[model samples]
Target: MIGIVYITAGSMENASEIARELVVRRLAACVNMFPTFSIYRWEEKVEEQNEIVLLVKTDSSRLDEIIGTVKHLHTYSLPAIEFWEVKGEEEYLDWVHVNSS
Candidate 1:
């Protein structure tokens, strides 16, 4: 199965670093990032901040390793990591599987 993982970083630099590591390790096929404003409750207080969001494409088999790598490299005490099953063009999905392997 293919998985699309989502993660947010405090800065573009951090996001790029994480993406590079993942791709280099073959844990992710590709990573797309963009800056956005995030509003959420933390420490019992609502806070809003600008953050970079990463969209990682990889194989489900490597999900655990990808998460661990992100945690190891992330700057956040508790980074937000989420994944969803995705269906798309067969060629694209196959590409993700081959690259992520």
Candidate 2:
């Protein structure tokens, strides 16, 4: 199975660092990062801030490792890390599995 992990980082540099680590460790086949504005409740207060979103593509089997890595590298005490099982083109899915494995 293939999966896409959605995570948010404090900045582009942080996002890049996490992305590089994931790729180097073969936990992710590819990572796409972009700037985003986020609003959420924290500590009983609503907050708004700018953030970088990281989209990680990988084999679903690697999700546990990916989560651990992200937790270790992420700056936030509680980072937003979510994922969903996804279906893409066959060749792409194969490529992701090979690279991540």
Candidate with top TM-score is 1
Across 1-101, the per-residue lDDT of candidate 1 in tens digits comes to: 99899999999999999999999999999999999999999999999999999999999999999999999999999999999999999999999999999
User: For all the candidates, what are their Cα RMSDs to the real structure?
Assistant: 0.5, 0.6
lDDT, model 2? 0.94
User: Could you give candidate 2's per-residue lDDT for residues 1-101 as a string of tens digits?
Assistant: 89899999998988999999999999999999999999999999999999999999998898899999999999999988898899889998999999998
Instruction: Please give the CA lDDT of all the candidate structures.
Output: 0.96, 0.94
Candidate 2 all-Cα RMSD: 0.6
Clashing pairs in 2: none
| Per-residue lDDT value at 79 in model 2 | 89
**What TM-score would each prediction reach against the true structure?**
0.98, 0.97
Candidate 1 TM-score, true structure as reference: 0.98
The runs of at least 3 residues in candidate 1 whose Cα sits more than 4 Å from the true structure, single-residue gaps closed, are none
